[model samples]
Target: MAPLMLFVVSMAQFIDIMNGSSMTVALVDISKALGFDSYSTQWIISAYVVTFGGFLLLSGRIGDMYGHRKVFLLGQIWFGLWSLVISFSTTPAMFCITRALQGIGASMSVPTALGLITTTFPAGPKRTRALSVFGGFGAAGAVVGLLLAGAFISSVGWEWIFRFSSIFSFLLFVVGYVAIPVIPAKAVTQKIDVAGAMTATSSMICIIYYISTGSASGWASVQTLPVLIAGLVLLAAFFWIETRLVKNPIMPFRIWRLRNFSSAFVAILFLQGQFQGFTYFTTLIFQNVMGYTSMQTALAFLAHSLFAVVTFTILGKVLPKYRLKPFILTGFGFRCVAALMFAFVQKSTSYWTLPFLGLLVHVIGLGTSVLPAQITALKDAQNEDQGVVGALYSTGMQLGAPLGLVIVTLISENSVDVKMGETPVEEVMKSYRNGLFGVVALGVLGAVITAFMMPNTVPAPPAAASAPTTAPVENSTDVATVATVGAAAAVVDLELDEALAEAAEKMEMV
Candidate 1:
């Protein structure tokens, strides 16, 4: 019951993460409706990611100091209020500010939700299942966000994305109030690391803003160079401060010493960059070059979500019984292949040949990599450390997408004009493909890093004869026997529970 409760709460957080990307589908609409030029329009996307990534560590630490549930609710309340502001936005500046606020809300929700899951669920089959569902739904919502955005953009208007998100926020607030239990009281004793938090946040904002704006102003221009330099310098200062001064830093310097953990974090960064690149490039190709309608573009991505869910379900069920390393390897290998294949996709190609096949393979490969990696990344981490673990992993994801977007935008802009019809579709797509190839190269590098760094075996079982372990082992064995003997009784009890949970999720999804 407790694990199930945590799983649902995490899913709500996934929905918030998904909402951040809905604007991609509405980018064209937003450009037209808000009268944004090419340069300003990108901010409509970049600002959200920048704020989300910037404050993530602080939000996680805040949740660690205060209660996770309290922080989560606070984020929802702020997000719901700002989402309404987004819906009513009449100018690009207004939209950007609101989106930035939405990003803050998201940062609060996502890491805290994962912290809740890690703290609440004991490591075992039950937790594994819940995590599989968590990873699965997050991937699914990203795909669904595009579809929903397309549908809303065309059927009603682009503003509906914000409207729907606002409504969803309200609903989640209500549901969380009734369904989610508070985190155990002892977990909230850590003090907030104010200097580390502020330095990190400000430094990250400076860097991300520099990169996001660099395309409009040349990288060498005065406007871009100062911000980039300041950001780099301040970020260095952040690390120095964290290591030397802070008693409890938001990102503890010690965790990076574990090769597997650092490797896993890098892997997530590369994979997420690859994922966002694929989705962004493909969607642009379909809509901008191929002249596909919003509905068509949205529907095109349906296969990605479906294939990811299917692969996740199969992989999740089997990984528990075997060493996790082989699955992780296979997933990365598949991901590299899929990403490389996607890099070769052409604007003139048939939808059935490269695009569909590439997306399917990528989705399946991503599914295999993510769930196991997420588990391995935080394996055996104490409850006190879960906030850092979640923050670290999710920071990889949030930072990766914007970084990828910045890279792709620079590549595509330098080589081809997507906004200009004078540029050939093939040439534009070629530039996009060039950017994707770089992302794929990063994935291949991540795979190699993971191969060497991640432990190559299952976790070792506790010693059976240890004096401290004896009583817990005996009780656990007894519990296992009782569970097996009472399997028939538990099966009936669990069936109703599953049905109810599904119904609840469906209601929330609506």
Candidate 2:
């Protein structure tokens, strides 16, 4: 594969993964800079997340209708534009809105880029190399983002983070414009399910809005309650519409018939919620209560980031030799233990204690989780739904972050007295400890879901992906090199699921 195509397709994933973590260390800076109160400030992260989650399904459908390359280029351009605007943002509203727009661009770029990769590479060793490159980068982007963001936020400025992203995005835009070939759309015509998509997106936005600001609004204010109820109504309507009204839905009901698939989806959804919630608040704990600088907080997280790389590197080698069950279960079990360990952070806690130990263990879990989960989520999915399932898997991962952050925000800092400046660090620490206990519970639940729900054996890669090639060889990028240089899967993202029941006619027919 040409380096330019690899860069174009994988860059967006890198940016998205990087953005998610890059902001965490800088979040305290953002809050103080913009004069945002705790409740309103949550939007800095949740705004991007709400849009990222809401817009994912619609964006993929857009790719199917328009040319994937065109949509991808447009998306990258949009992201570059938004990143530039974000660096110049002078107010909280400006920052939040621009970040949301950035998420929209990201939503547009990712699936289309993957589609471009698939269409660009023939379905043999070439496609495998492309996918291995693609997935490897997708997994690694978050840690790279964290490292750079941490180093630069203090050395340069948090604003430099966006400036760098803007520059990289534009460079990719130019390169992609010149190099990314236009691929013709397939003959399959799929409906966009406009109504269901809108309802679902709107419902999620409203619900997240309610969770975020509802705490500061007194949780049941007349204005907030109505929005919350309306979100529920819209959510109910979305299900009804998808199940009965739409000729073809954004999420096909038939896909849920695979028990493993369904179980994987729920497990991922919960795991992500826990993971992001943990990251957001833990970032706060390290910087705020622990009195660490942005640089220090970033450095503290360095262990998790480094170990994630090592674990993935080992998995790439060992996965082919091992049944996924041992790796998958052990990874999830480590995650559960890590969460439980993190729940023990204290006001006087040493960095090397539960905080460091737990983070180290958690990264190992993340490394093991991503590949098997990706393999599992797409396990029995037909080739036609590959794009959609991949999109769904990505969505399942992206959507969890904001909701988890919201729940943590509410539980840890919701008291009106705290806003009134009557709260002490001791009392605040009490709330933080309690809130983290809930996080530990979520992690345990996710592990439980996987242990009992996902298949106990390794699933074979899909036939289109794994079958031997008799087709004439084309010179390709060295996959072993790519695997050796494999990337990181975030504790906060890339949560895929495990395998399902035997591929019988009932589920495969779709």
Candidate 3:
């Protein structure tokens, strides 16, 4: 039963991730088919990214108010329906709209699915193993997706990509209904915080949309400036909703108080940021300076992709024996070292030298860094909060990555005419190096935060060796669990308990 549930959850994640990778690989072909230019084609991807990041918090909170199973099933149905619709899209507008809806569905499913996993597995090796396969799919599935999309586009057609997703999604939907438990709505504690959710989701969409457009349209764009300012205003409104005005906040302020979680969030933010910068600069080196073919550029990343899968597989088993701090600390060190090495790369550097070695080192850091940070952030997580935590985990990546890439793009934009074959290799090398130096600094900062703020010790095992197979058991320990956080978060979570405690204190005072 547990295995079946795991299968459902993992496959849900696999399909969601594959959607992005497959789209990226087939972008050029799709553009030609849909009559899209370089500028217009971007909307196909950006629409999906913005909507996914934007609605995560709201969706996650919705799961908290409703049962995760209901929400998860609804999202799956939504994703599956859109995947079929996408195949019929003949125009660019039609294609982009369908893609955006698909992304929203994917976002809705992921956090709720994560919530299900947290409830299914106890916090020990069982849970660790479950999460490993779940998280590992994200990295390995991307590479696999590229290979599959290329194969399908050449042999069958681009529409087959969505066709395949729809077929698989239906199968998943059937098995999920049978295997996953249904929690009654009466089990829910709080009503939906609609005001808080709306403001936050709108603000995030506005911010990510601004960044996505600004990167392409130039930072000084007059149209882009209005979006940026509007996003900032919405952000201020969101903060006001959460901290000052709301009686029941969508995001409780005290979730930010977990030292380990906060530290992990910061570290991963920098890690993702630098990784994006490194990928952009590396792609330029291969295609622009070294003049590799598109196929060759894709192939260069294959090794790192494989390395990530194998490394994560090993770490899943190895992590139970040691503290996460060592792995996180070591991983960030590797990240800094690789970025620093890449900063010194010359125009004519060999494929097997520092460039190749640096890719290896960087993936090592990435594989190691990602999982431990996830483990640390989700540590001491309560059952109900799982959806929100998972959403936050992903949001850091979606938002942090854009910020990193934009900064690097700005630093490296020196009018190097590689597309027209007019620029000097010497100029290209200078631009690449400058971009990489910024990444090196990002890596270093991540390492420092992990060292100072994150927990150094491995967590103690679950209070009992086993939680019941049918229902999740709550932890009773005093390791800064939900009650402690809720007491600080708002007047809502512990109202009954808090009122009693206060009354008891008053009787003793008399």
Cα lDDT listed for each candidate? 0.75, 0.69, 0.78
Q: Give the TM-score of candidate 3.
A: 0.85
How does model 1 fare in lDDT?
Answer: 0.75
Q: What is the lDDT of residue 500 in candidate 2?
A: 32
Candidate 3 Cα lDDT to native: 0.78
Candidate 2 C-alpha error for residue 341, in Å: 3.4
Task: State which candidate has the highest lDDT.
Answer: 3
Candidate 2 TM-score to native: 0.79
lDDT of 1 at 1: 48
- For 49-97, candidate 2 gives per-residue lDDT tens digits of 7787777767766664556668788888898899889988889999999
Pairs with backbone N, CA or C atoms under 3 Å apart (clashes), candidate 2:
139-488, 140-488
* Cα lDDT tens digits for candidate 1, 174-269: 877766675445523566777888889988888777866787776878987998898898899899998888777888776777656676787777
* Candidate 1 steric clashes: 0
- lDDT value, residue 98 of candidate 1: 86
Runs with alpha carbons beyond 4 Å of true place in candidate 1 = 1-4, 187-190, 343-348, 408-419, 459-510
Error of 2 at 47 (Å): 2.1
Clashes of 2: 2
* Winner on TM-score (1 vs 2): 1
